[model samples]
Target chain A: MQETRLDTARIRAARQAIDPVFLDTPLYRCEALEPGLGCAVSVKLETANPVRSFKGRGTELVASLLAGDGRNAVVCASAGNLGQALAWSGRARGLDVTVVASRSAPAAKLERIRAFGARLELVDGDFDLARERAAALARQEGIRLVEDSLDIETCEGAATIGLELADAAPTFDAVLIALGGGAMATGVGHVLKELAPGVEVICVQPLGAPAMTFSWRRRRVVTTDSTDTIADGVAGRRPIPAVLDDLLVVADDAVLVREESIIAGMRLLLEHAGLVAEPSAALGIAAILEDRDRFAGRHVVTIVCGGNVDLDAYHRWIGAAPAHRS
Target chain B: MQETRLDTARIRAARQAIDPVFLDTPLYRCEALEPGLGCAVSVKLETANPVRSFKGRGTELVASLLAGDGRNAVVCASAGNLGQALAWSGRARGLDVTVVASRSAPAAKLERIRAFGARLELVDGDFDLARERAAALARQEGIRLVEDSLDIETCEGAATIGLELADAAPTFDAVLIALGGGAMATGVGHVLKELAPGVEVICVQPLGAPAMTFSWRRRRVVTTDSTDTIADGVAGRRPIPAVLDDLLVVADDAVLVREESIIAGMRLLLEHAGLVAEPSAALGIAAILEDRDRFAGRHVVTIVCGGNVDLDAYHRWIGAAPAHRS
Candidate 1:
């Protein structure tokens, strides 16, 4: 499939547009992990964000852009953090947001969205089914569809994370971003390529959800039959075409990290960086840990994408990991 | 009791000085609880900080100040978040840190402090004994003593949190800070009073460890026979005189939040803010929930003081909350 490159200038403009709307999360150098990895590892602490996720960056930007012409209602489908971000951002602007999620979506997350004053729509189906229905309903009602992956604005918004990172740690040799709808990787990678062209941008995906990994290898978007992972935030079935193009243009490589690695990564993030990351958010760290040699002796920054795991899930996942993992 | 008015401008100046060093932790407004309370209750999420606590603010400021003249070693007597913060900050600036803790300090915390590159000294007695040893050792080794509360720099450093809160939510009618050595409550409250004179500053202490609370009420520092609480971070016997004066000038009231309330507060911070705060950090939230009417129709901000609770302690606390209580 043919692809179009996102202009670097446009990415910078997106940064300015989104800067005031979301938190400029800190970047901290991880000395404990650095020596072991043989790399100057820095963690982009997105968990410090209002919604406890980098999704706030994209969701707030998209919400602001969509609400520009007085639109006050938005709809989306998310299993966790995305819904919370949309709800909180919508509440901030006095806009109404409806989140459609499967019955299996953690009750804690559902409660969080409600806490932010967003209307909840319990779709009696899986996340993909809910997404499809949400898209259809949004089109019918003329309500802005804030689809996480399909929307160009969402990708542009997620890309601002890259801009902030590059500005904060301009000396990094490589940037690692967790793969979801490919929006974050595409957006961040695009900007980093322009700012520091020699720097490598690596996209990390859980082995269970290797849609992006498979798609990049096949050079086309592909669907997975079954992609089950604890990293629910990034467990998308297929990649978005626009984001795929951006990924192809900027991402140097894609790394598939195991579920155990993701869990270990979360534990390490908490222990060393004083940050909490959901399984999906820790994929970048997992990827690096899985193959430390690739990042050895290099200045690297890993994005801790989000923190929205339910207590039951968190206890089970974090507990399953052996102590002294860090 | 006579108390001197605080140097409000200096407190503001200290805040500005640490602005670049400390992460601007979010003030997340709880819109869901607002309807029930008839007030906007927000959390100053110190748990999102680089060291996973507001202790980072004080530690960063102290470390920056101490390292100014090429000094490299600093020592502290804390087994909780303060030790971890000082250790992390020490490593970041190429300084060495030693944390002295009682033999009773949790093994988990000792492990974390070591992981952050701090030398650990486990004294034979309780925390007070460990503190005494740390002070003597600091003098003998020519190491700077990063006193948690007694040091003027420590109070000034903690005051930045109040400045950040005022900047983030200037209209807040009341500010709730967890009472420790009275440093956090004193420093933060001092600034809040100066920034917004009408703002009521209330200090919350754990019922079991209420030395600061007792000191304020008695108009002099008082020692408890035995203090035990889940909030180990705020479990101190003595209140620094300077801190007591600051508290007298700015603190409108002091409340003792029950242990059960602290547990509930931790769960709420985790579930709502996606933050992992220790019991001490959640004291302010506990105070609000326990006495919801006190803040009705008012805009209130609570400083989540710190985040260094053992994972097991967190699990046990959150799991053990009685069904009737919640």
Candidate 2:
């Protein structure tokens, strides 16, 4: 395998470039979760940020760089978290942002993007179609398009998380990351591979949206006819080649978790960890639960990538009693 | 009124003494919540710690000090968060901890305390009765009872929060804190008053449990006949005189919020901030919603003190559709 050159110095710079709100998130040993997983598990709370996701780090770095280069506006297509990140960081950097999201995107996510002062353009098709619209818009003068997984800067921004984890707990046997478009896995994996050479980087995806896992196994991009998963954050049918290339070098293995396991992960996190993690973010925990034999007695770190679920959806997932009219 | 002398130097030392997991929590601008309150609102997420509450800081510090002084076992009475904090920190420092609680204490909280390896004594009475039992137990030879709000060392431990807020945003017009036993309000307020004298420290309590607010108003410890509120964290009928003394010197104003408003605050936090805040933790937000006139156009910081609600209780509070079995 050809090793890609990911600048450690640039990753360090991204740590400095990104807003402080997204940096140094809570990474603590989850005592409540450890017993069930049969291992020492530490959770990095990326959802505690203003955007309720890890996307803010990469998007803020990209937005800052763009704004510094005299850009006035930017556009992106997102399933959810990235759009909100771009909108928030863009608003901070005084740049106008337009997000092209699929009509199927969660209402909570769409509301957050608009709340951050971004223009929303909902496409009638899936996320890929929204990406096409964003790409077409980018060709027009004065507008730059940011593609999350495909963008090197986005991955570089995410590498800062690895830097923090290495500084905090460098001796972890494995780090489990939820794979969506693969930016989080690649970025954090690259940094950990460099800093903590002994640590294994594992990527987890929902069985319904295992494009990245399938592609990684075959050493190429794999396109599925359709994707269906409650974890909308990782519900993708296509894999980007750039993200795949990085994953090949950086990731040790990729695993698929059942949709039922993902739902269980969400409930465990909410009840024990006291975190309202979105379904996508809970995939890492699901992976751990599915393969307890591999993780038993080993120290592991799981990234809670986001928490952007609507209250109603969250209630349904957690099996809580219906809302009362007090 | 004679102002009490709070040690600034000790507070700075406490910032150094506490565990890193409970320090420097995310303090960011809450964009989704701002327009509703008609002000720039920032939230300090104290719930991201291992105990999912701010009580860890104080309990850990007190436990460390006790362990250093050759103490092996400690007793404490708590509604929930504080006991969990003591149990967790005591276990970490190799100290045996016994928590006395009311029989009516939430099952989730009791489970957490047991999970942290603490002995639980359920008294068949209210919190006051539990406290009396704990105090009586503490009088036995070689056993020290750690009271939550009345201990100066606990308050000093909590002062570190103010140090962090001052470092993050020192120019805030005011900071609102939810008052239970008055330790959090006094500790954070004392530091803010010293470092950022211009920032007003406002304390909020539930109307059903207005002991602290009434006592602060009367400049003495005031005991109500009974307490009734869904915010179990702050449901106290008796105010400790020492805590009241600290509040008189540290707090600027104390306010009461309705139970309905507290429920509304929990929903808003869950929907907007993506935090599953307990009713007591939501009191600051409820106060803002109840009195928009005082907070309009001003930059305010609200400390989300804890998140330890059961799933069913949370669903009931947030008015989500009833839980669906898979």
Clashes of each: 2, 6
lDDT of 2 by residue, B1-326 (tens): 34554577887887666788999998988888887788888999999888889999999889989989999999999998889999999998999999999889888888899999999999998888899999998896459989887887778878888888877556578899999887889889888887787888999999999998999999888899989999998888888887888889888999999999999899889878889899988998999999999999999999999999887777777887545678
- Stretch of 10 with least lDDT, candidate 1 chain A: A317-326
| CAPRI class of candidate 2 | medium
What TM-score, to 2 decimals, does candidate 1 have?
Answer: 0.88
Best by DockQ: 2
Model 2: pairs clashing at backbone N, Cα or C within 3 Å: A320-B323, A321-B322, A322-B321, A322-B322, A323-B319, A323-B320
Q: Mark the regions of model 1 whose C-alpha exceeds 4 Å error after superposition.
A: A1-21, A30-40, A91-96, A114-125, A270-276, A320-326, B1-8, B12-21, B31-39, B69-74, B89-96, B115-118, B138-144, B320-326
Top TM-score hit = 2
How does each model score on lDDT?
A: 0.75, 0.88
lDDT of 1 by residue, B1-326 (tens): 23334455666666544635365666666554455446787777665444666777777777777778799999999856778888877887889999998777666677778888899998987667778999999999988887777777777778877778777655678888888887677777777776767788888999998888888888887887767888877887766776776677778999998888888887677655666778887887788889988777788887776676666556566662212210
